[model samples]
Target: MAGMPSAHSSGDSRAPGTERDGGTWVVIPLFNESSVIAGVIEGLLEVVEHVVCVDDGSTDGSAEIAEAAGARVVRHPYNLGQGAALQTGIGYAREQPGAEFIVTFDADGQHRVVDALAMVALAREEDAAIVFGSRFLDDRTRPGLLKKAVLKTAVWVTNLTTGLTLTDAHNGLRVIRIDAARAVNLKQDRMAHATEIVLQLGRTGLPYREFPVEVLYTEYSRAKGQSLLNSINILVDLVIN
Candidate 1:
């Protein structure tokens, strides 16, 4: 694999010969998700054999668990935000031989492999560069009233500012074409990266689409997910930065 950009301060190692045996490479930016990393990797492996878990300075041994589950683990020396983690993973995946597609999935186990595969198919069918998964398109996994309202407002603000009409702007589940993934650059290091991606995609004029997907909000994710204030912060970040 080619050396990662200087932005990756440390922890960019690949398993010997693992990069050559690739198909659909799923890039999962992992934080301290030790409780769920194993299961998440296992579930992802069921659909796609090549799964890259970028462990973003996880103190809870998330890298070990992911590696044990048959995933190619890329460790970060310290805690970078999810956006940075994602960029690291994507860069690593791009270096792999026979890297066909890239999928950005959540480490919290909220995203589904079925939905990801569907998005991949749709990206190929529509000839789109990127395909975003929209929870608002389906009623299977519903957010709470306040959470729904805040996220909806986020979509509105993002569309108004970036001129990209999307139903769910902050959804993490997305399938990006390998060629298009090379052009995708994320600047925002935090929650705001979601909006940054949309804006960047728009500016680059990449063919993109939204697909209906389920986001299972379990009690754990609800407790660990973004708060109301975080939504406002993301909006502010988009406006100023």
Candidate 2:
């Protein structure tokens, strides 16, 4: 909700519902992902018309490449964590006309558009406020043993703390109705935001479901993704903050 006012208060003529039924915006929070963001946006545009990429102060030309790939790029003056970038993109999507739904996607190219489309379709069919993707529910995704163990532990901890029984608490792929989108206020500004989202939903008591989805962990994602130390830090941050 922090960035929602700027979209209108700035006196922009393009109000929310500018696209009517086509108001589904895929929000991708990007870092120094110039190497992969173009292809990511290209694939997302194939399914959804409005793709908002928030560049979290990437030194690389990520914003330019994303804009060239047909994404509306929002830039941060400095490096904010993934959580802050997501909040910015989500707020922008909220102000779009006919923006009925919003999807949180990764710029690492690990997420599949087919999965996102499935979540979007599910959101419409069930009238669910939120639909989250779970890699553990599907057999197609093969995470490394260590990664699997860490994430499984994370899911358990999140469920225990948030009091929600979600199989995949931290999976990035998620779809939410406009109401749920407006209600999600993230403050962690880092990997901790994943947990924060669940916590917020628990407090709001929004309807949520988990759908099985596939994740392709190539060398790039595995190398650039969260590490064991980062995971530990996330737990500490969640507890302290």
Cα RMSD to native, each candidate?
Answer: 5.6, 5.1
Q: Give the alpha carbon lDDT tens digit for every residue of 1-241 in model 1.
A: 2232222212324444443323578999999889987888777766665788999999988898888887888888899899999999999987777677899999999998889989988987889988989999879878999988998988998898789889998899988878778876887888999888777777767888999999989888888999898987776777785
- Candidate 2 residue pairs in clash (backbone atoms < 3 Å): 16-96, 16-97, 17-96, 17-97, 17-98, 18-97
Best by lDDT: 2
Task: Compute each candidate's TM-score over C-alphas.
Answer: 0.88, 0.90
Displacement of residue 195 (Cα, Å) in model 2 is: 0.4
| TM-score, cand. 2 | 0.90
After superposition, the stretches of candidate 2 with alpha carbons farther than 4 Å from their true spots are: 1-21
User: Which regions of candidate 1 fall more than 4 Å away from where they truly are?
Assistant: 1-22
Score candidate 1 by lDDT: 0.82
TM-score result, candidate 1: 0.88
